[model samples]
Target chain A: MSRLIRGNAVSADDWTELDDATAVPSTAKVIVSLARWRAERETLAAATAIGVRVDNSADIQTLWPELRDLPLVALEFPKSGDGRAFSQARLLREHCGYQGEIRAIGDVQRDHLQAMQRCGFDAFVPRDDQDLDDCLRALHEFDLAYQRAARDDLPLVWRLRRQA
Target chain B: MYRYDEYDQKLVDERVAQFRDQTRRFLAGQLGEDEFRALRLRNGLYIQRFAPMLRIAIPYGLLSAAQMRMLAHIARKYDKGYGHFTTRQNIQFNWPKLPEVPDLLADLATVQMHAIQTSGNCIRNITADHLAGVANDELVDPRPYCELTRQWSSFHPEFNWLPRKFKFAFSASLNDRAATRVHDIGVHLVKNDAGELGYTIYVGGGLGRMPMLGHKIREFLPEVDLFSYLEAILRIYNLQGRRDNIHRARIKVLVKALGPEKFIELVEAEWAQIKDSYLKLLPQDIERMKGRFDVPAYVDETAADDGSYTAKLAADSKFAAWAKRNLRAHVRPGYAAVFVSLKANGVAPGDVTDAQMDALADLAEQYSFSELRATHDQNLVLADVARKDMYALWQRLSELGLATPNIGLLTDLICCPGLDFCSLANAGSIGVAQDIFDRFEDFDYQHDIGEIKLKMSGCMNGCGHHTVGHIGILGVDKSGEEWYQVTLGGSAENDAALGDRTGPSFSRADIAPAIEKIIQVYLEQRDGAEESFLHTYRRVGMGPFKARLYAKVSAETEVAA
Candidate 1:
């Protein structure tokens, strides 16, 4: 079983990720590829607790119409160095106003956790080789940030200086 | 110079601590070499030819006297009693040990300095006009914007993993001293029709194997929208820039692939969404940043000149020669900016010894307002020296061997730490520089040659900015042997152009003679002493120079046959 981090804690994962080839079980809390979702939208429409997984290259603006109805949007990082997912996650949150859980999936590691968090990824399915506890600690590596991002409550230090 | 606030200091401190932990983890065998490499690179620690090289960011090339002392200390303690200032206006400690890099960074933090984002596939150090505030020609100061951009791009969560290294340069002068046309993002501080301050933004400029000048994407970006617009451009680049091929990964390639118009459209579309977001700068925000860089306490010098300056010039031709080449026009009357030439003969260009650095720091304190600026041409500037102090300062600098009387001459060439230090170099660039310096040892000869930018790079990486040099030299490897290629008529200034290749490559032995031939051709072909080398080249269009360069080789070949 994969270790999943939700918010700040390692939590038990209930959602099942199914690739494009897999048939979706009607009653299960399942996540499917964006392609499969498009193909079987009418069928998956009645199913509850459904999520969609999109590639980093997929334009999030195209999914803005359906973002509010979705509970989870999983962004892929095919390689750890490929940071397109960070932009995707930010656009989903800041521009698309995506309020649902943004999950980081493939190749997610401890080093990327804090930055991923800042970019609005609340759920991280870390790679199997990484220790879950170590990755959990990485989420809070930086207590302060220089700029305001998806998480508005976190201080924008420069703006705070004006008030001070 | 802008001082670091509590927020800036805390960020650097936290970054050092984070890197310390990361280094510890790597040493403890928890992190693999590949993983550790990525982490260390962002902190500007590179496993170079012999030892790890740590590049420290002197943001916008501005350094305080205390900071210079710290650099001197770091040089003596950590490096080989010397440091190399790079073309990007940062300093490099070549012999830093890997395990001790975190400690070095921690030491840097005490003086509001860090190596964060100095390397790696991220935004590198932001550079601006070295003559930012003091130049008489500047319309506005560009350092405040550079500082603001520096803060915004520091560990930017989204941009830290760009497709390749990104660089930004800012210029506000009519003459482009910062080489603004050849950066990833070149910002020119300009005024719109309403006389309101704004930026004219250039995108996708870079130099490497494929050197391309930046294209103007935005004619007028309102001052308040700097960050938001920068974010939009970086966002598009991060999301869409090519990553499969390392050579083709720079933003320049993306701009080339999807013509400039499409790139502008995408950035504008993204900017429209986040323009009014938290990243927007309010009037107070601009004022707050501007306040940090308010002009230094310049002494009233209207009646300060006691005619001794003119008297000394007439009395000592040596002092006059130094003044003619080394002194720059400052906006403040009776005050001048001084260039402490790092191109003194025999030493490596841009290499300052520990003792020299310490003494230079003292000189900065005594002359300029305890502040120094590093030029992109691999030299340092004391930005505000009184005209009366010119003779005294020159004497002190000459005693230190820092006054070389060659500022823009052929000898004051910009060079990279080539094969001697860099693992990427194909040949040793410093030796070639020395040979040329030895050839042109005569100051009278160089002064007659007049304002030639001779730049060289070890490889196609163009770290020495060979592409933009008026006379460019590139080191190439041929069958495990080093060969040098020369290009002529390139420049990094307002009329920036890539140098044209001058025939075939030359061996290490013949490179200096080949350069002599090129200069000989220029002297013979030039219109008059009044016409610069660049102007003569433009008028003649490389025919006479190329013929003269290759004719001797053909004659030798015929003689051998």
Candidate 2:
């Protein structure tokens, strides 16, 4: 519910291709989270990963672990400030170690890429008209960080000492 | 005073230059207002009701005289004369221009100080018992640990972007003067059975709209595991904390919802993954920091110093009274802790003028072993002053009106800088605070009145820590007019509890009389001065105080009572 952002098309309630894994594919085939979020998301994740998209709330306890091995995981960012997806992306890469394509779908702006990248999302799936140049700049912006991020193992302090 | 080392100097210098660049970009219109908003706040600049207010962190409220001179220089050159000392032991200049912040920060950098993490949702300045190294009752000086935490938390990467601002306090003694119960993370440093220092960690406590005391998350967490454990807690909160709604973002609500046991499991699990890593406290690093805070040189002397102090007392009763109130044991012979009160009558609490700050710095340099502290009560504490130098110190401090000698009395109030500066405030806190202070100026009466805490906040934000004061006054605005609300029997000691408000609020003029009535009732019915007001008030019920506060209104409502 937090990802509900208002713009051209995406809403929080509407899941991308691989965001949620659905049991009843016949009923909700319209939505699918890219890279298939079914594998990386564990059932302990408080939310479920249904068929291809749109998981049931009650099934999150069971389905999250069931979808831990999905080859491709697509995390959704329905809103700018909605940080639930940050947790989702992190759980996929760090805990679940889902190494395939982790596309940042929906409301993935240039500014938010830093946190998203730090949290472990590899590839960004921006809007068609969005500038790729700006996105690339954000990826290369700050070369060092102080905390242990899902993406980088070396915190800034260690890096500082290494240089010394 | 702890001098800045190479690392500290480099960090501050780089930070100022970075801010200077950021400020230039913003003025050049490269960064939009919203983008620049967060950036400016990270540099401790905020757009307030009047002008841009800059909050500078007085880390644990410890600063050398020369550093204070630099602060005074900043106030004179950049700000509008004075600075407000916050309840959290930090100071804020109300009228600094946004454009001038870079230069101001540069000025501070020259003195080895910068306002980094003073504002924003980052680790705030660490605070401890004001009488840290010198308080007679202290187990071990908490300043080294405070310094350690200060260094670790400053610009810490992973925890910087927390859901909300985190406040951490350390207390090394049995008496909880640091208000550990009400901090995000409270560390109680204690010696274990094996003669090793360990900590009892309290998490989730904060004072805001949802005021809740922190729960003990970790008991006997060894000193070595401190930083790693803290990092684990931050990571858990950062990853799992609800960032959707800011109101529910503080770790308090998260800990409340998750339950402390599960939260513990989560943190321990996280810590296990990161323990023994680089974040672990190295013995040498701690030793280096501790060495800097070595005990100041002490000269041996006895209580009966040449019969000179007693002679002064015989000559001057005022000096005797002042000595009795302001002087406390310094854990060293021939030295005493001098309490320089900022709570002068009719003045804003904790606020000192640029001139006064320079004078205090000069005095500290000359007499107080070059060290001063900002007490939680918003007063100044000279941690080490010679016992033989009392008269001279008093004379100099009295000249600048700094030696009020009302350390814990009526004039030593904790008040918020309400509607005058803060737009979030509902009523004027300064006026009521002034009224309370000016009304209780008689030294004998105040001393006889006994140790009482008068805390006032403009609203329930609890900036003045009204919840812990014995006589808590909260400001409420009713139909464009300010009314003062009263609460009794609150404390911030080991036996800490929130004060309870009486039935209704009072008009500004009636507040002093209501308090007077309550005190009169206590005086008439209480045992003696040895029994503190809070102790006596709690021993009895709020019934008496409540009854007196509402006596007139209750009389009008009832035909006969």
Candidate 3:
């Protein structure tokens, strides 16, 4: 089990990730792989609360229109160095307009939290060894950002103009 | 030069603190080497063969006198008492200790300079034409756009960890001095039919293991749509570019894999979604950024009083030769842009000593408008030098061993820090450059065979831009010995083309003679003195040059036997 940081708070993660071989439970909050979700969309969509996990290699645009209303969508960072999840998060937010809980899972670290948040990840399942407090502090590393992101609607340039 | 505001200052200061902590963690064994490597690389620190090299960004090659002095100070205090300017318009310190890099970065930040994004898989230093604002044929000054892109790309959230390194070059002149066509993303400022300024966007161009010219994706992108369009292109590249292989991971490979049509379609799809977002630049944003690059105040002087300059040129043949080679026409009347040659015979092409840097800084203050630019050709330029002060500046430069008068000559070569410094280099580049310099040391001879660009790289990485030189030389390793492969007819100008390989690779001893034979063929075949080496090669084709180069090698071998 890992500590889950959801929108600036340490939250008890009720969500259970099910492998493709496992059977889907109807009443529990279950997250499944993108393949399993596609294979059993109707059965998974009818659940009380559901989520889908996407790999870095998965075509994120294919997930939209069919899987838009899921309560959560977790993007996988297969390794600490791989950054395809960042692009996936942005596409989910800006292109698909998916406003549900977006979580960063698998190899998440303190150093990646700020960038993950800016790319529309509202929740992060940090690696098991990282301290939760350290992960939380990482989000506040920069008080100002130049580009407009999920957290900041207006970029710094526009905000500065308004202030002046 | 673009002065850092409070916001920019705070960002750099915080970055310094962050790197200091990261370095401490790495030294304390809290972080592994692989983990710390990525962190340190984002700060522009590279672990080279001999020592750690830190590349400091010059930001479009523009520098104030104070900044130049700070660089000199750092060169003296931190590593060896010298630094090398890179083709990307940045400088590298070849010998800084690993433990003291945080302190070095702190020192750099004090002078409004940092090595951030100068290395690693991010948008590197945005380079512009060295003659940006002062060039007579410029359409618009490119420094403002370069500065804007620098700000936009700095610590960018999504694009910082790119699949491969991304390079951006901007040019707004008739002459493509910035080598835009060879960059990952090249922006050429253009004016539409309605007289509205815009950009011609090119993507996918890069050199390295695989060299390809960037394809023009957008013929006219409105000035306001700059950041949005850039964001779209980067996002698509980040997700779609290959990650399975490091060699095929640059945006060029991705763009080539999916043809330009499909790539443009995807970019358009992404842009359509984000076009109206806050990422779009407002008119005020453009104006505000433009205001940062305020033009230097010029005294209204008439060109009618250049009799003294003309008389000085007439009286001294040496001064006339130097002026002809080292001076360029400035946009302002009665002024000339002076190129201070860093390619003096014995020195590495771009390496400058601490004392020389200080002297150049002082000279910039005295002659130019207290500003200087590091050219992509590894030289310094006093952009706004008055013609009246040309004789004095030349005399001072001559005393400093900087008046080589070999700008655009064969000896004015671009070379990478090869096996002596770079771990990736297969052979030594500076040694070959020195050998060629010795072979072509005569000034009159160099003038007779005019305007040849010789670029040599120690490896296939092409940091020296050998793939685009008129006479390109690539160093290869055959078992344990150093050999060189030569190419011909390549250029980096408006009509940029990759060089075609000449016949066979030559040994180190024969490389200089091979080049001389190639030059000999050009001189023999050229119509007149007006034709440059590249022009002659293009007109006559490479058949004759190749035949002569290889035939001479066989003739020499038989004579020796």
Q: Count clashes in each candidate, considering only residues at least 3 apart in sequence or on different chains.
A: 0, 26, 0
* Candidate 2 residue A96 C-alpha distance from true site, Å: 6.0
Residue-wise C-alpha lDDT for candidate 3, range A90-147, written one tens digit per residue: 8888778888999899988877788889989999998887778877888888777667
Clashing pairs in model 3? none
For residues B1-561, could you state the per-residue lDDT of candidate 1 as single tens digits? 787788888888888888998899899998878888888999999999999999999999999888999999999999889999999999999998888888899899998899999999999999999999999899999888898899899978899888999999999999999998999999999999999999999999989999999999999999999999999999999999999999999999999999999999999999999999889898888778888874778777755465789999999999999999998999998888999999999999999999988998898889888999999999999999888888888999999999999999999999999999999999999999999999999999999999999999999999999999999999999999999999998988999999999889999999999899889988988888988888888999888988887897999999999
Root-mean-square deviation per candidate = 1.4, 6.0, 2.0
- Output the worst ten-in-a-row residue range by lDDT, candidate 3 chain A: A153-162
Quote the positional error of residue B212 for candidate 2 in Å: 2.4
**What TM-score does chain A reach in every model?**
0.92, 0.59, 0.89
Over the full model, what C-alpha lDDT does candidate 3 score relative to the true structure? 0.88
By lDDT, the candidates rank as 1, 3, 2
* DockQ metric for all predictions: 0.74, 0.14, 0.59
| Cα lDDT tens digits for candidate 3, B1-561 | 787777788789889988998899789887778778988999999999989999999999999888899899989999789999998889999999989999998988898999999988888999999999999889999989888899889888899888989999999999999999899999999999999999999999988789899999999999999999999999899989988899999999999999999999999998998888878787878788788775777765564235577889999999999999999998888888899999999999999998889999999889887899998899989998877788888999999999999999999999999888999998889999998999989999999999999999999999999999999999999999999999998888898999999978999898998988998999999999999999999999989998887886789889999
Off by over 4 Å in 3: A23-27, A41-48, A153-158, B302-307, B552-561
Best candidate (score: TM-score): 1
Local error of candidate 1 at residue B303 (angstroms): 5.9
Model 1 lDDT at residue B52? 91
Q: List TM-scores for all candidates, in order.
A: 0.98, 0.86, 0.97
